[model samples]
Target: MKAAPAAQQELLRLQALDTRLAQLAHRLNALPQTAPLAELATRDDAVRRSRAEAVGVLEDAKTELGRIESDVRIVEARIARDGERLTQTSSLKDVQALEGELVSLKRRLSDLEDQELVVMEKVEGAEGAVAAIDDERAAIAVAQQSLEAERDEASAGIATEREQTDRDRAVVAATIPADLLAFYEQRRVRGGGVGAALLRQRTCGGCTITLTGSDLEAVRRAAPDDVVQCPECDRILVRTDESGI
Candidate 1:
């Protein structure tokens, strides 16, 4: 523990480097997907929704058309039964009543047919929309396929980078002393994994506060190898070329 200040500084530096490398690796691992892949996923969802809405519209139109047809059939049946009753009647008043009923039934049938025509038109329009949606879905599928292929390539590149970084981390870890590593680890946990910071302009890297004039003078006077901790934040301050001592 009574080693030269230079040795202690090197230890702090090694620990800082290891911590930074680990953080970078963690970030690379947590990437969601390739950017293109994420974009394609969003488009895929929208296309599916559009297709579903189109299909739903067509289905509703079909149901309405069916109801109209059923009503027409019922009116026709009523007309037939009334006509049969008229044929069996001999009274003039009864025949006149039968004629009036027949006329009303015919009008009902006409109205039902007109309503059915309107629904058929709607069905045609809905079918057209469904066709449009189908085409859009097909295009989206093709685009998604292309995007997925590109994303796979990008992801593979990122994976390769991650492996290389991991190897670099192993190399760095092997060179670090255990006791110094433990110190760094404890400080990192306490400072939210920011155990080391590059000293610049007499300010503490961890807390971004300028040291008191006395503290700055004391640190400046220390040997180049001295591992200096910021009194305010207790973080190991690694002097860089930018440090305005």
Candidate 2:
């Protein structure tokens, strides 16, 4: 392929713009807050799970408390009926039986009330646990929002730079001949974004391999307008005065 020396030099400028754009893309992806935001998401999920478990425990405790209260009500009703019967009965034996049942019913009510208190305590503890988890989730949400904002700000700055770089790349690319540009684009894809490299001293800048013997001799023989490729990496060689042919 043949391209003017000046055009070849423009290729390097185009490469610079492309490299800058790539760097900006990388910076956008690796914003400082991205990792922390990921961590915050994980923490938020855990807090949500804990809250769900705490709520389950709270509901169970409430149910148990309800059952105990119902049992106490039934026992109290039995005690009242038995006491009334003891007062109105004519037979002493009947009164004795009613009195004995009243005593048992009162004791059973006391036990039920005690059980209700323990369950109520459990409900309070479960509620506290849920509240703590909610607080943690809210904190995580705030942190995630902050990190996302920071990341978006950084990305916007990078996007601005990339836009300018794109304009610059278009200008430089327009200066390159169509066939030569196509050739460079192909090589750039193969070389991981480097299509052309400056040959400094005796080294192939693209692959950092020094040209020796026949490789160096061939480059020396090429015309000034000729587009020469690096033997090792196949990148177009853009020679300058500092190339040390």
Give the clashing residue pairs of candidate 2, or none.
none
Clashes of 2: 0
Give candidate 1 misplaced runs (Cα > 4 Å). Answer: 1-56, 84-95, 167-171, 174-179, 182-226, 230-245
lDDT (0-100) at residue 76 of candidate 1? Answer: 91
Give the per-residue lDDT of model 2 (tens digit) for 1-245. 78889999888898788778878888877888978888888878888888888899999988888888888888888888888888889998998888888888888888888888888899899889888888888888888888888888888878888888898889889988999999999999999989989899978778999999999999999999999999999999899987888
Per-residue lDDT tens digits of candidate 1, residues 1-245?
Answer: 23344445565555555565666566555555545556777877887898789889999999999998999889899999989999999999999998999999999899999999999999999999889877877887787787667656656766776677677656765565676556666777888767767778888778999977788888888777566788888877777667888
Error of 1 at 132 (Å): 2.4
